[model samples]
Target: MKQQTKHSDARRPLMAADQSGQGARQDEDASKRSWGSEQLAAFEDRLRHLRLTPSQQSLASVVLDNPQQVAMSTIHALAGELGVNESTISRFTAALDLSGYAELRSVCRALANRYSGMLWRFMRADHGAEADSESGANRSQGDGKDLAGKNGTSGQRERRDILAAQDSSSIAASFARIDGVLWDEVVTRLGHAEHIAVIGLRQSQAVAAMFAYLLGLVRSQVSELSAGGARYLDALRDLGPHDCLFAIATQPCSKDTVNVAQWAKSHGVPVIALTDEVLGPLAELADQVLIAGTESDSVLSSMTAPVSMVQALANDVAAVDAAGTRAHLERQEALLKSFGAYADKDL
Candidate 1:
């Protein structure tokens, strides 16, 4: 996942945020950059729900299934290629809410550009140009002649952009693998629990802390169990079938987290886990499992996707009982104001 662009120098992932358990966006969760094709998804949903004539269906597949070919073909050529009448092709585009074949072709062209390995090409072209420019400048400078640098920092920026794209894709892929049934089951279990204990260490500590904090705001009896002074063992002892254990662990899984999870599972305390692998140690012990990708360029792994999961869980639990949550938050706000723990924004 940490594919380096520069052969001469491997990426150090030397950023301070890597060690701080932060990212560039969403409160230092994931990379800050957005993918260009973020909103551009396949039209398979439209095809599934729409009814079409035989000729229209043929046209639909030709235009939407593989838009790259359609983008390069004229309307008449496309009609001929699909053995569909020109009128049928026009009708297909109309049904898709396009003005005509031109707009349809435009849409297809955009999709084709995105799916056609253009990102890799863009990086290669820019990187190669920068390398060539740098080489020429180096040779000239070695001969005691100075040459201006070209594309100064653009190549470096593109490298970071590619990594951001990779992180975005990983986040998307991780979310896509979620099981709807298990998600609802876990949400219900956590929302209705009597107590919730969160355990995380090393790379997973930030995620566990955030989940515990957010879950605590909407529901009491939520705690982050650390191993300091054997206190977590005391906390685990109180867990029972009525309570839930939320565990977070990734590569190089913490022994304490795993032991605590095993303890919970054996004691009949429902365990829910957020982890990086499908078959990790935490996953084995968890009653319910959620997966996220921690692959990153740095020596430190990423927790971006896990942070997103924490937000989703806390938010869903908050929504389980609207009235109770609202009252709880109101009381919490009053307590905070009374203690003057936070500065009053109105002042």
Candidate 2:
């Protein structure tokens, strides 16, 4: 049975898109920017999947309803409002993987910043805004220093430096979590699979399709799963031990995504999951799980690391069968030219 949140209708299609990449990619990227909304959706999913005590459920409702207020309130105040002891509040935070009230406040603040579209701006201004020496008013120190202190500290240059640092940290985190041997095994299997089906629901659709398109360029047995209806299950039914199901999902992961992965695993089909956190429902089901870093100080989380991983796998596959891969590309190019598939020389 598939589990769905009480607010599924509102969130299910928030990340869902049509088969076209040009339009879908735009929407997917936009959805990824709403980190606060995504957090609430994830909480809903957790509520559905995990058994919760009545007090915990009530506490969650209050937290979700007014996270900003919770951020301003002390533990004693919250406990008094809920008619619960302070120890109960402490236990609640622990259950949610938070350390204590302070950590809870930090999370709420971040989410509030996300909702207000001020996280990145606030962070940049925190360090970049300098008090005017004469007037004592706050002003951007655009000429203080550069990232390396060698160039002028223009606001644009400082922002670029901060974003670049974030990118570096995220890529490092991905590499740290990824197991080289496990990834190589997945790549080797993909190279030899008789058929390959890529599954990604909601925001992940764009990623899964991009992966399939890239693999298709090098080989001929790849297909992106459709979200139409029961037909998706039929596609899964057709898959066997010789086929591979590549799935991509991220935080606030969909329940339907987990269902398909579970089905494939139970049927003895190999499953590969690309996701953010190191441990989750999808990770438990996948034979090879790749963890990608989605952390960011800005509005949108970056997918550069995950996309790079997919590209690497495709490159390795091409390398494994160099002659065949070259022939495939040649045939594809010839067909494109013959059919006038490209718009112009620029294409």
Candidate 3:
């Protein structure tokens, strides 16, 4: 019975669109205009069909309540408040076929400012028509329970239809930026830094550690800030003027991460932030803000773009010191072999 219910729920979006031509047309127009209404509707539909993870559902509710105010800039803070990672916010944006949270915010703001009058009237008329149609359908059904069931089904269908209308190209384009000049810039920065300090909290902390490890292979003076309440403050105390802070922060922002960036800036340390949007607080504090794509199909945040950025930086740094790095590796390999660290199985 549960399986049957789930199947029925999945089909509800299509059924609702079939029943409401105007609603379908409105969604289509919103997609064409790159207005966020279509994306918002699709997310709501997916929630109804697949049942969002609790965190996703919470994020969805927040977006719905403040459609105009919510932006990619706020993703990290929102996620933190919900006890989820910044990546989750990226995934949510990706699911909507938005390049990332920044694009999503631009669309929402554009739609709100450009079409507010028209949208208000359209929404009022649509709601009135829907209410009338629902009333008539209920009257025709006669049985109250049957009417209730039909209304529930209709609501479910509306949500699915919206999800089906999202654009794939938008999502692909958002991710494509990672392979371009932005990544090159990140690589150049890492290659030049005298000392690198990687700072991130929660999910971003893992990415920070990866950057530190990769930098250590070539430059030696690389350190990763520990997770919150894990000796990060003590580690950061050693940061100085010739150092660079490579920060990874995403929406639903972290206070500690922002503070670290600010501190680095005040201490005459350069800050490079890998982030989702330019409007985020961390971006304002950063010497360089590398915008990484965060669109994903699941509730989890998308790390592919940021990871690619880090790998590109690693490669570039290695390239810049190729001869020296190779010589160092050879010496280390020889020492390890002499110590039997690379001994064969027969030995």
Supply every candidate's count of residue pairs whose N, Cα or C atoms clash at under 3 angstroms: 1, 1, 14
Candidate 1: which stretches are off by over 4 Å? 1-156, 344-347
lDDT of 3 by residue, 135-249 (tens): 2322111122211122377755743343222223224444554435555556666776677889888667778888888877776678888775658778778787777898898
List per-prediction Cα lDDT, in the order shown.
Answer: 0.66, 0.65, 0.58
- Against the true structure, what is each candidate's TM-score? 0.55, 0.58, 0.51
TM-score of 2: 0.58
Off by over 4 Å in 3: 1-185, 228-230, 331-347
Sort the predicted structures by lDDT, highest score first. 1, 2, 3
Give lDDT tens digits, candidate 1, residues 1-347.
11112111112221211133332222222122222454334353454346777677556544443455465565555665668887887777778765556556566656555642334234323343343343222211112221222335874565455556656877887777777778888889888999999999977888899999999899888999986848998998889999999999976588889988998898899888888745457876677888887654322456888988889989999999889889889999999989989976899
Off by over 4 Å in 2: 1-160
- Cα-based lDDT at residue 186, candidate 3: 60
Tell me the tens digit of each residue's lDDT in model 2 across 229-319.
Answer: 7878888879999999988887557688899899889889999888874445787678888877665444455677777778778888887
Candidate 1, TM-score vs. the true structure? Answer: 0.55
RMSD of each: 20.0, 15.0, 17.5
